[model samples]
Target: MSLLLAAPILIPLTAAVLCVLAWRHRTLQRGISIAGAAGLLASAVALFQQVSASGPVASQMGNWPAPFGITLVADTLACIMLLINGFLAVCIVLFSLGGIGQRREAGGYHALVHGMLAAVSGAFVTGDIFNLYVWFEVMLMASFVLMTLGGQRGQLEGATKYVTLSLISSMLFLSGVGVLYAVTGTLNMADLAVKFAAVENSALAVSLGLLFFVSFGIKAAVFPMFFWLPASYQTPPPVIAALFAGLLSKVGIYAIIRTFTLIFSHEPQMVYTIMLAVSGLTMVIGVFGAAVQTEIRRILAFHSVSQIGYMLMGLAVTGAAVADGLPGGSVAAGASASASTSAVNAAIPEFAVMALAGTVLFLVHHAIVKTNLFLVGGIVLKLRGTTVLARLGDLYLTRPWLAVLFMVTAMSLAGVPVATGFWAKLVLVRAGLAGGEWIIVAAALGTGVLTLYSMTKIWSEAFWKVTPDAADLAAAGQHPTDEAIDAADIGPRGVPIMMTVVAVMAVATVALGVLAGPCYRVAERAARELLEPQAYIRAVLGPTAGRPASASEPAPAAASAGGVPSQR
Candidate 1:
């Protein structure tokens, strides 16, 4: 348990600190980074073991009890998230060996990566709401530096938009936190869970919840707030882009789920309805955006937003189902008074379970698969020395393995069967039908098909077509600017073998589909834990942890799913 808590946060922080202390020694910095990443992986595995045995572990910082001080909690979900993130860090570190080494100031890049890892891990483990905010800032700061690491014109331009939007989002989030603290007078999550119950249906609480929703929505790239992502994410180096794709947006989703289930569960109808509406629009807009993009990374970036919509759909239905009532029990007892009992009986229609499972499974699978795609793209650009669809050509003959890998990744993105993507969409669609939400079900299916279309467009343009064979391209009459052709020479080409190895490992990510059943069962248990939260509360506040520090009664579990009707 100690290793689980310490390794993810400390291993990375220690490495970053060491690198800073030995900034002049590039070799030493590399050694520290690799060792730290390796230790982080070991710690993740160890944490998984502890979670498997103990259910969940909570460590109060400095040995103070949960509500009074800070605590780091690791549940099955947290452990699994850590494992995926650790694996990504390891692969990206390996990928960075040659690329980051070429840069003049490697120390800062390496240090920032480590710091970013620590921040991400901290966000996952921390039990205090304010702590989550701290970690968000840390991670964003690292991302800004990494995005601009190349010091190129495009990167600087993109980073400017990225930082501006991210800063604004952070300010919004901080302001939300201030309002929440002002209302509840507690920042610790479990402690607030208790306090929030007392104020469940209050206008103040609902308003605060919306503030967080907007703030996290921006970070998560959900719908209206997603404009900044496609513009900035495409400009970073492959390793950094892959890291951002795999982990950064997830933190936003995690925050939403955590707050919805624990704090805002009081208002299921309003929250879930809004989520459903936004999700539908997000899917439509994101895929439509992808349809128009010719750039490889930009298309993938749009798909990220689309996929987030799918993940949220399940939760919206889950909230609706839970609101409809638990299977046969005293409504009052089942309310806030017996949260654990109600949670167990919630019976999230098999489809909902399947959908939620797929969502989590997809999150893990997408992280690996997406990273692999970016790395493979990097390799293609390396050999051809160009990423532009109009200028680049003939990678199929030059790098067969890379071409094949790209095909598999693109197909998986298209949600073809036997791939992890198939199962994700399948479950999501099934859940919508089970909830009698036929329109949502149809929307999800349409998104999958559109996803396929977008993917195939990229495949045909970048891989299948013969480039430089175009009459217009070679014609002297065309007199196309020489600068367009010279832009291809801006970077190195020739896919390195190490990168190819990194890309190939995505096959394992696909294999998770074969093992989906057990994973789903595990996800169910985790979901149950999330919904009940008694164990979490006990872990944080202790059996005798008593009431919230504030003077409000536990919000009554309203008979309806809109979390206990707003306490008047």
Candidate 2:
């Protein structure tokens, strides 16, 4: 069980190590990268299966019990995320083989990618908030390097913005952890939940919650904090941009979802109100930003920000079920009433589950679809030598398969009927409406309309538009686009390696749409676990996990003598 739990992290870490050792041999590094990603996907699937068969699972280090040792856990949510993270790593690795170029490859590109993967896996599985922060740092460092791999002027400019914002977020997160640990004296999330809830300092609790919210909000790139994403994501290599598109902000969203659901859930109304507002603005602003962009990758980069808004809406559009109490074991533990506000927070949100399911499904859909878009953009860049829309046209007539692949993901991104995007939007809209969140529903519907516009912009500029010939370029006073890059092959195996990736992902996007039922069900089940986290708590901290320690019980010296201590 422990091996299974560690496999996802270990495989990627080992791959990174081997990549470093074989840095001189790009072939060996590439081989190891592919193998590691495959192993990660395998471990993720096995973990998901084990969790399906036997509920949430936890593994402690050094044979130590919960609340003491470093712990790795896999609830349904974590399993699903693990699977997505691993799946994308494979796709990105394969795609990078062609596009990442020899300069970056020899500059530790494969090793850094694997390092980022390992950190992401760590973040998903770690049961400790402090460890979550640690993993975030690892992810940040690896991404910072990946962002600036080639030392291009554009890469450096983007890396500056990315690292600057990222460091601020990390600082805030570490501060939140410091405050949380100072107050509760435990960094274990499960134990921190119970202990933090038992604290009587309302000011401290609410303030800390908001502090953490701001920290994660910045990372998640909500509304006002989203400017850095478009600036940075579009600057990297297409494959790297696609990887960032697919996974980076979603990890931030993952952190937000996990923290809000399990730890600071007592006062959800504050988060609810704030998230709805942020989500709406994020959606509109991001789409508007994308609408005005002519660069294919820049437009997709802006769409990534918009998509983050959609994911955050899941948590925003919870329920009138808040009136009934029972949000996160808060009310039952007599901590249900809002400590910050007088609004009743007895939450048993029916729509919350559905909304969250929409989030998970969309996360998967957007990761595949959005990344596929960037990958396709890379195809254009390689074929035409530029991603600027005005220079290129008539891909549909020339590269029909590429056209089809673009449409596959583009339609999905637009939320067209029968695509995964449609169902994801439908579920979220329904959930918001059911919860009486008219603003969220409107933002969702309105955003979809604008999302369609963005996709159409890309379709027209990048594909359907007729080719601008050399004569046309000179007539229009433009540079040569297809001069040296006319249908040119990419990668060691040429176009096949790159095409295979887009083809595979396009198929997966359709499969997820056509078979959205099981995926949604699993996501919904995970939502239930998140809303009612006792099973998760118990799985990590034994049977007594969610239960608050009584003053009558004997105190433990470690974890501030107020934690749910080791029983054996």
Candidate 3:
């Protein structure tokens, strides 16, 4: 079972190698990509089941002991993430069949997509902080290339902004890692959790933790740090935009959740307060940003920032719950207060688990629904030649099914009933109320209303009232300027493969909404593992890894399917 931990990363990586080898043969590369995606999905299913049955598991490379070697660990959290990642891989690969043009395919786009997946999976499973950093670099390298592919003016501009922000994030992350190693002499997360309990320099330790928060904040595109996202994400083709929207920011968010719950709770009152402020502002600013955008992808880009704020809200609530419920409120305290502080370390507060579980659900729902929206946007671009709302008018008449699909995902995004987003928000809101976070809860509700308005903007302007074909675009648009929009330069093109892939994803969103119980259970279980890290520690280190940090020391505290881009 420990071997299955590596499958997610290895499968896509092998496929990427094969794709590069067959670069001269597009058909072979295509078949190889599809097969690889399918295989990853299969592996994810098996791994998820195994984790569910046996609890968390870890494997050390070269059979080295804990804190001494490379480690791959999979708890419920890792497996659930892998499951979603594999599912999105399959969807994005299939969509690329008709959505991407031959020129891009010949440019090793399949290879690049697989490479990106490999990096993402590596990030999900790695047991060391430094290993996580390496995966981030791998992801940056692949995504930067993907963004700049073909070197179009917009693509180059967007890639530049993307790389600029990403490099800064990398520097901050590396600097934090240096501080951590200098202080703790270890980089393994489980080991760090143990040692962090014993560190006496609360100020320096928290400063190190804050450093990571800022780094991940920048990466996650939280408010103030998020300006680059709409500017760049909108520049990619809708397919590429969808992939980034679904996965990249979520990884940043994932990092934030991981570090805060596991290694940064010593000063929770201060940390979570600052975080709550950031989350509230992120939601407000992101929704307003989307409201000002007329392009489909740009609007979605801004909303991505808004949705991320909600994830942080859940994190804040979870942090508060964990800190308050654990007697003495810090790992240092837990270490000194008990004879068997390991039991205290292993315990998870009920409230913290519920809140984080809600966060996990939101993360899953957001990835799928957001990716589905981007694919719908791509279909509109393929058929209409542009995403400008004023230039589009009659898609509802021309493609009723496309309109329905858009409504399905858009409704889900706005948290309408019978959609996964609705349930996710409900859980978060409930958790927030339980934790007495009334202000942030109010902010979240207001953001949902604004989110609906933004989605409505897209529906009314681009989808509800426009011609979907080249022949009628000139006569049907919102302005005489629409005549100058050049129908022939774009659409009325067929997107059967694209539509088919989208329909399947659409069904998935609805199914997730209707059958949300099993998912909720899985999410709650994952949250438990995160808050109670003893299982993870034991898995990576050994059966006795959960022993107290030292004879005199305190106890320790406990702890995306986004797609590839398409070219048209």
Candidate 4:
């Protein structure tokens, strides 16, 4: 079980080392990357099955006990994330074979890609908060190298901004961890949850929570903190951009969900209210930014920010459900009682589980669809030799089949019916309405309209419009076509690997919508585990770990706010 739990991280790290060793042999490197990605996907599936059958699983490194050793955990949430990461890594690596170009591969491209995958898997499973920091640093280092692999002017410029801001966020995260540790004296997340609740200084706890919020909010690309994303994401290769879009920000979202629900559940009202406001603003800003972008990748980058808002909306609504005493409220209130001496535990309303489930569903749907869109953008770049919208046209005329695939992903992203995104959005909207979060509800609906408009704009300019001839373009006084316009560009031999990968993702996007019920059930189960983490705590700590304190119970004397007692 421990080996299975560690497989996702170990496989990628091992693959990266092998790829680095075979740096002089491009074919060998590619084979190693592909095999490693396949292994990761298999491991993730097995881990998912194990978690489903055995409940939350945890492993302490070097046979050490909890709170004293490095711990890896595989709860439903982590398992779901790992599964998505595995799937994306496989598709993206395959696409890279045809799309990343030979020049880039010679510079250790496969190694960096696998390194990023390892860091991502490590982040998903690590149970210790400090170890999460280490994983984030690994991710930043690998991603920085990937972003600048080609050493192009634009790539260097983008890497500079990405790494600069990411480093700052990392410092903030580390500082927050230090403060949290100073207050609670434990780096283990499960232990922190138990220890933090016993601290007397509620103000200090909330302050530390805000620190984490800002650090992760920047990483998640929410609102004002998202400026760095659009600036840098469009500069990298399409596959790298796709990976960033699909997985990077989602990791931040995952962290937010985990930290808030498990460790910071003590102050639901304040934290969630802030999240609700930020979510609405993030949706508006992201769509508006996308509407103004002329480059294909830049537009997609902005849309990534917009979709994050929907995920945050679900998160805020879940928090609201806890505050309002909705379906899952008992779980939150119970978790809080176990951690602290708070008096606001009186039943106010029933917490709706749908809100949390909607967030998870949205995350899954967005990752697949977003990555497909970027891969499609890569195909466009291959066909037209440019990503500028004005320089591109007539894709639907020259390659109708490719147009079909683009429409599938675009419509899914725009939340069109019978696409996975539509169901994902529907659930969030329903949850918000149920929770009476009218502002966020309006924001979500409005964002969807803007999203559709942006998609249609791409369709019209890039596909519906004809590729104007040199004379027509000259007559219009526009800059001459950067690359000669040719129908041959869309021929089968252009990039079969990229096309195959996009097609697979497109089918998955549609299938997710068609099979929404089962997928949603899985998300619901994951959300339940988040709201009530007693099972998670016990799994990591031990069966002897008692049930979390009930909301109605008086605070235990040993748990007074002065400080955590010395009992281990």
Instruction: Write down the lDDT of every candidate, Cα atoms only.
Output: 0.72, 0.80, 0.80, 0.83
Candidate 2, 349-388: lDDT as tens digits: 5677898888888788888889899999887877667888
- The lDDT, on a scale of 0 to 1, for candidate 1 is 0.72
lDDT of residue 222 for candidate 2: 87
Note each model's CA RMSD in angstroms: 5.9, 4.0, 6.2, 5.0
Error of 4 at 98 (Å): 0.9
Every model's TM-score: 0.89, 0.92, 0.92, 0.91
List, residue by residue over 233-273, the lDDT tens digit for candidate 1. Answer: 78777667778888898888888877877777665456567
After superposition, the stretches of candidate 2 with alpha carbons farther than 4 Å from their true spots are 319-333, 337-347, 471-493, 548-568
* Clash totals for all candidate models: 11, 3, 13, 11
Q: What is residue 31's positional error in candidate 1, in angstroms? A: 2.7
The digit string of per-residue lDDT tens for model 4 on 1-568 reads: 7899899999999999999899899999999999999999999999999999988988877766677678798899999999999999999999988777667788898899989999999999999999999999999999999888777777788789888889889999999999888876678887776667656566676788788988998899998799989988887778889999999999999999999888876664777889899999999999999999987888999999999999989988887667665333333443445542233234322235788899999999999999999888888877666777776799999878889999999999999999899999999998888888999999999999999999888899898898877687568666433221123343345487888899999999999899999999899889888877777876776654533541112322222211121111
- Using lDDT as the measure, the top candidate is 4
lDDT order, best first, reads 4, 2, 3, 1
RMSD in angstroms, candidate 2? 4.0
102 Cα displacement, candidate 4 (Å): 0.7
